[model samples]
Target: MPGGRLTHGDRRRIAAWLAEGLGYAEIGRRLGRPTSTISREVARNGTTGDYAADHAQRVSGDRARRRRPARPAEPPTAEQPTEVVRGFVDRFATLLAATGLPRMTSRVFVCLLTADAGGLTAADLVRRLRVSPASVSKSIGYLEAMEVVVRRPDPGGRRERYVVDDAAWLRAWQADTGAHARIAAAARRGVEIFGAGTTAGTRLGAMGEFFTWLSEQMSGSSLTASAVYDALTVLAALVHAGRPLTLGALAGALDWPEDRVTAALDAIRRQPAIADPLALRTVGPRTYTLTTRSDRLSQAQREALHR
Candidate 1:
């Protein structure tokens, strides 16, 4: 409430105003900002207990970063260089596929995510991805469905471009919960295929129930997975920020075992969340992280749900 920016400061005062018995119009009049702005600022940032100034500031900062330095590309490289660069797409596509996304789908999204502007219209995508407009359209539609990226109105012209935000992967993470639900349901159905009384069925059914229940707890319970992911993400960010952190440091902070921390890191690293485990180097005190195929159960769950 004390330190605030335009959209944010206006909110802090508005909350206090409401608590002190000031109406929206009264608060707007007092702040000299529009009533709608004040209303939205509070509505968006206000929590059950408090408005969370730190959270508000982080959101505002993220929004600001999105608006900064639009597409400052390296001096447009020689056009011919692209021929050489296009070959890299295969490598890029391979990396994407390894992360569980389709090859073309991975390439298309990665190209957009890493774009200097963090955005590209369909035409730009076609040119960059070296694919027909149809291919771009199809891949982009899937990416949009996955919430891997989002479309925004282009300031330059009529074309709407898919723009990657700072929270792009977080959106991707949010989408995973739904995918997990489908997986859990499918796993439950697998019990019948393997015979409910058999070991496989019993194991698969339990797997399905556990994943479904865990996902629900994380996503729909009082404490959301997104919140936990956010906190861990900050810790991950700090680690990647070049400050050396000991495994014990995080263990003390989260009150978790070193091996447990390592396992969790391995899980996330295997997932598309980390992209590179090297960034999470201290996962087990100098031991390299291992690749994991954690979705085997999730896939079983998805199949079970359909049954």
Candidate 2:
């Protein structure tokens, strides 16, 4: 496979392919390059209708010359080898891409995540990733939209830097929970359209219930993701025990402090009353049990279950 930057000859062939009305994928296939490479090249140089190979080559050379002086120096570190870190970045980016993130966006996110200062300017990203400024800009925009990255005024200069921090993860979680809420709404709409008695409606209803529950668990009471996770862990433990247990017993079972267990129970109690099917009940003095709420299912669903 062809690797590295596109050559002058490659630009000429791309121009010829554009004149032939070949799509990016087809041009990439013929040139032995990825579709994104061909697309980015054409987009950076000119539109399909007016692309000029000579002009593209001249501009590409100009960009390279300009970027040469701006490239940041990296001092070798004994603690973490540069090659090993780069390899890990590539591998993690591939895993993120497999999870349906756009490949460039995944690469950009991982780059920001691994930065020593927890942030990098656009120029820094372009220089480090060896990608076009436009590619970096597009990837940053995608990450910003997903709430996984934020722009802050650079401390050293006027340029805005993209930073990924603890708050970024919380924002990303909120964005994800918003998606689950939307799915729940859409599923409920499907139930309405298909009629509640139909098989499709029944399926959609179940989907709606699950997504609604998930969205609630994820975003209820505006709790932090870690807090929600802790509460769920405590709930899970109680469910596994299958009997009422004192706070000390619960804490011992989970290897957590009694105060931490108390906090988790409080977080669970703060959730909206209808948010979950299971509830934490105080069955005896200083003992708690998990109980299923009888009202979790609708009348129609309950009757159907009986039938």
Q: Report, for every candidate in turn, its global Cα lDDT versus the true structure.
A: 0.65, 0.84
RMSD of each: 28.4, 13.9
| 10 residues in a row with least lDDT, candidate 2 | 76-85
**lDDT digits (tens) for residues 12-32 of candidate 2:** 999998898999999999988
Task: After the best TM-score superposition of candidate 2, give how far the Cα of residue 221 lies from its true spot, in angstroms.
Answer: 7.1
What lDDT does candidate 1 reach at residue 227? 41
Instruction: After superposing candidate 1 on the true structure, give the runs of residues whose Cα lies further than 4 Å from its correct spot.
Output: 1-88, 189-196, 209-307
In terms of TM-score, how similar is model 1 to the real structure?
Answer: 0.42
| Model 2 ranges with Cα > 4 A deviation | 1-74, 77-81, 220-276, 279-307
- Model 1 residue 99 CA deviation in Å: 3.5
Clashing pairs in 1: 183-301, 183-302, 185-305, 186-301, 186-302, 186-304, 186-305, 187-301, 189-304
Best by TM-score: 2
